[model samples]
Target: MSDQPPRDSHVYDGPVGGWGSAKGIAAVARTARPGPGAFDTLRRQNKPGGMMCSSCAWAKPPNPHIVEFCENGAKATLWDLTSARCGPDFFASHSVSELSGWSEYDLELAGRLTHPLRYDAETDRYVAVDWDTAFAAIGQELQALDPKMVAFYASGKAGLEASFLYALYARAYGHVNLPDSSNMCHETTSVALKTVIGTPVGTCVFEDFDHCDMILHVGQNPGTNSPRMLHPLQQAANRGCCIVAINPLREKGLLEFANPQSPWQMTLGAPTEIADRYLQVRAGGDIAALTGIAKQVLALDRTQGGVLDHAFLDAHAHGLQDWMDWVDACDWAELEQVSGLTRDAMEAIGAIYARAKAVIGVYGMGLTQHVHGSDAVGALVNLLLLRGNIGRKGAGISPVRGHSNVQGQRTVGITEKPELVPNDALRDLFGIAPPMDEGWNTTAFVQALLDGKAQGFVGLGGNLARAVPDTDRVAAAWGRMPLTVHVATRLNRTHLMPGRSSWILPCLVRAEVDMQDGVNQQVTVEDSFSHIHGSIGKRSPASPHLMSETAIVARLAAATLPASAKMPWDHWARDYARIRALIEVVYPDDFHDFEARMNQPGGFYRGNPARNRDWQTDSGKAQFTRPAALDATGLGVGPGLYRLITLRSNDQFNTTVYGLSDRLRGIEGDRMLIMMSPDDMAAEGLVAERRIALTGAADDGIGRRVAGLRVIPYDLPRGCIAGYFPELNPLSPLSRCDLASDTPATKGIPVRLDLT
Candidate 1:
């Protein structure tokens, strides 16, 4: 393998979703070699009673598209359904030390894990172990430690059943230390929105796209993160709905899209212009931009009386005047400087919002992965509340989540906060007094591991080691743990970082059949829109040694818990309906008739009370929160420093690297490169392809740096830079995070670039 990163970089001026998307699918298919059956499986994605796309949390449309899967979705599905298998023989050939040197893409491409493997310290290799022995060993390790010292981490890929069982097992064993993928990404949305709108979830459904007059596309690249969303954006554009994109980068998806399914559009190469206007705001300037927009809206309301929704505000909201007063006090010069946008541009967007009868605010991790992520979300909510966007048709705040079923994991009680869990119901149902202590979030969990406070870790799914900030420090702490167990479909970087006693238990992927007690089972997932639906696997399992996640959790709980425990783990493992029944008992309002709803054509919508103006806050009304200042992220980027925004490539999903090509950005075979503006390159005396090192500019004494990164001149802000995630995650310190959400400030890290 070559040590040099790919230096081929050019401008991609094409549309986002035409032949480019089709070719992307073809490329993955070539690498995956998923066979002819994979095509049939693709057709079934997002269809009622069929398999769900495992890529993103975008809601399934009520009237579904024939081919619902998008490029990334196809990649995720084909990647899972690939024929390559990583058995004991493959492990025998490559030692862990040798495998650690491989790229993330190469590691996963090696194929799906086919058996349970236990780390052998003597041989320095993972040796195959029986399921019974693996479970017993893991259970014994857990039994030796205090429940508070054990962390149960879950990935969004797992189904609601598995997540519920995982949470139950953790709580029944006497701990609430349930840190999940949400902690790393959307925790800001949950924490901020709950305080603003009395609900942690978005208010709009799939049908909202049709009725909305405008969509404020804030800080999200839909083409790569969630391609299924393109259909709605395209439809919205064709129907003359105003779409304004607010982000640091001019994402191709937000600019234009061609429906691959539409033959005329594809043939003519006439892509739908998605965004009517695009604002390239500076990194960490989301709160300032939103505040400026809100200020403009308030100005319009003062000049034109009908601009503000006084009726809605008077009836269903609180703190409007206080927030409006704060906005009025903010000076235009400060707002412009902080937001990196002219007052005229903000006014133009505000004018659009004022004219639209109903507008939807759509954002992603860009707004939620900052030091003021929670405040940024709160600011967006304040703007929406000014026009009565919530509790109405065609209007609301929508945070586009990344992973499939991630929202469902939180819905099924996989959270560190004890208040989020239904402890009363759990105690009554399982006859166990659940711990109410506030447990560790992702940041705190890593700290505990480093401090030697945590002894064991159980990962339901996900690459947590690479997903979090301070990777080098976290990996070292992970190695020192007494025990760690990961239940996954494939081998990842997290699996390579073995603890003192580590075990990798292979589990069936979403594409594979999950059979329990000779009966085929279907697992349910909750989408970003809060729609609960069932997903049944259409393909065969990669290996006979694999078990379903639900079965693994149940069996592990049975093995770990005392004999006096009242839970019927064996029964729940055999039949998932029993697990759903317990879930219904815990969350009676949402999961009522869970099995019956799963059997429905499109399942049922888990209703949001805030949609109907029923506020669950202390004041019984939606509240307008005032940001303390124009700049929410308090990082000061001096002459030599830049505000670094971490990004995902077109060929990647979350931490899963599918390939080296980022077709949308016109970059092929590279992940270790930074994007900078031509002017900034010249000003800093740097050239394209120049190797540089980025050191975190945080005042903390911890020296965090990433070297051997090539610089690529692109269309970026003067003091702003961009790079791929996880590779740059090392520059974000574990301590520098959103105080309210504990989500690492991955989007806006202050870093100084030095020529290598």
Candidate 2:
């Protein structure tokens, strides 16, 4: 009878630390009598309120640290502490037209939606309404749109008092289409580093990686996406510096990273060897591998002529001879077939920038997911201004940004426009006159929701219909928005791309607790090394009917403004330190002492005067231009066309999904694949893992096909392919992007493929 007691002895009883030790010993050899919820699902896998330590949003904290998370912040803290809940009688039994036909992880695992919701579109569903009738039906649908038909997006995990009261309720609703998630990642390094070194971000810090000797990790990875930048690239690669990388996918956490917060290197399992020089390149061929490493650093300054700083290019700079005549008119075999890299790996990355005397580089969105992504970030700041590597200590140019207040939600004002001087000291500090002009970004709010001229769609925490690309043309231009709202903390696929009335609202959760009015607030983020800290939560609000994205942007700007609007939105929503004293009367030279430097504790210091060389540009120096050499066959190619690109995984970030798995190109559960280059998969006879499909040549050309995918074949190069972004954002076509930063070149999609 004891031998008969073997049905599934609590299947795979424990330990799964590194990629599930052979699937936890093959679930203990197919369960010997398992079922009792298999030891309560292996004692609830990531247990202790899963979502790994020091409050995640993919942790950083590090200053006098006590371990801050990472590993995609422990898979975004087990996908936001999922034990799920979408209460209020599951939206009174489903209806925003059948829960907008479910699936954004089944309306965020059906949980934590305790209250506020509205979309009763003829009772087609979504009702729980109560935060004052869902902030007066989003202030009666922003008082029936036409404030330039409304758009207000802003999601870099909304903080700093809900993006300064959602840019003071969109300049009290005049307009400024305020699209967010920095127009889908590093708005081409914030429009080419604020038009060449006036600064949009990254003048480097964290003790400038201890005075970098060489870094260059172009087209970034930071081990499974910013694993606390693997303990400063393992303390500058155990003090030997020179990293390099330039990815196309060799990324195994940049080839070996162990530092789980290094305690003498995590008890000697000590990994971090991070790329001393990898360089696979290819996808959108990072501007012909950054102009073939600036033509081998201008042929090593013509055979090492004092390694050229030429006195910081004759004091600061400007168009160095039309960037040396577009790198001596390109064509080194089409820069080795668009950067599969090789003139001895472009002279060993120009001999580590001519024996580095403090280098840095960095970069992400694989060089700004691009169609000349701002001329490949101005040719990596024209190879860091051909050696002056911007203003000093540990060279410059970083770009790795991915949320954590996406560059502090474009520094306090979730832009789209409204900074062309709305100032009258921010209209006597928010009394009125904020709307200045321009707006609608994210390619003009997806072309004003595809030219219906945007109706309404607020967001304030992204997933903008799966971080946009083409995705059924941005979910059919967000279903012709007649109101879409969202605010969120959970539930995504851009909250079911609905509209014609839809809400969701929930909020809170940057590792929880927010409170507001009665106090316990905190917020404020901005990191990809621009610093500005103070995050303050410590778990709690997965419920209690979550809210605090600064109390839903001050009760949706006091239920959509009009007591003839003029700020004082309930005294700056009951004080976020008077919304940093009106963001110090609108960015007083980088937020003067915004509430005494956010009451100290890693939060103040906007100072980035082009990291010292000053140049707030329009010339006080650091201005450099000349970029044309463009022509990637100006989108007209054949011989089985090509290009593609997309990317982002190591369990994704922009467009959430913490794990559908991608453990560095060994992919796993599946993100469809594609990759390419074994000579373009044996010149399309195709092989490695096969499958394929692609298509899209533009406009009803097989209406942007896609099909199976798979194909794999590693080290990409021959005319490119890649994949990943919102699953190959249907091979990217919204009339491509980056004609000087309109952005959407989600890393170059032109396509053709086949062999499915």
Instruction: Give per-residue CA lDDT, model 1, range 1-756, as digits (tens).
Output: 001112332567688888899888899888988867788888988888789889898987767888988999999999998888989998898888888888889899989899999999877789999999998988888999888998999989899999998998999899989998999989999999999889999999888989999999898999899988999999999999999988888778888888989999889657898888888888888888888888888888888889989999999889988888888888889888888889998989999898899999999988888888888999999999988999899999999998899999999899989999878888887888889889988888999987989888999989999989999888788888889899988889988889999999899988778888888899999999999989999788999899999999988999999865468788888998888988898898998988888756555898999999999987889988876555656676577878989999999998898888888877776799999888888888887888899998988899988998999877776798999998899898888788789999888888998774
- The lDDT of each candidate is 0.88, 0.66
lDDT (Cα) of model 1 = 0.88
Alpha-carbon shift of residue 456 in model 1 (angstroms):
0.7
In candidate 1, position 28 carries an lDDT of 85
Worst 10 residues of 2 by lDDT: 1-10
Q: Which ten residues in a row have the lowest lDDT in candidate 1?
A: 1-10
TM-score of 2: 0.35
Model 1 CA RMSD to the hidden true structure, in angstroms: 3.3
Against the hidden reference, what TM-scores do the models get? 0.98, 0.35
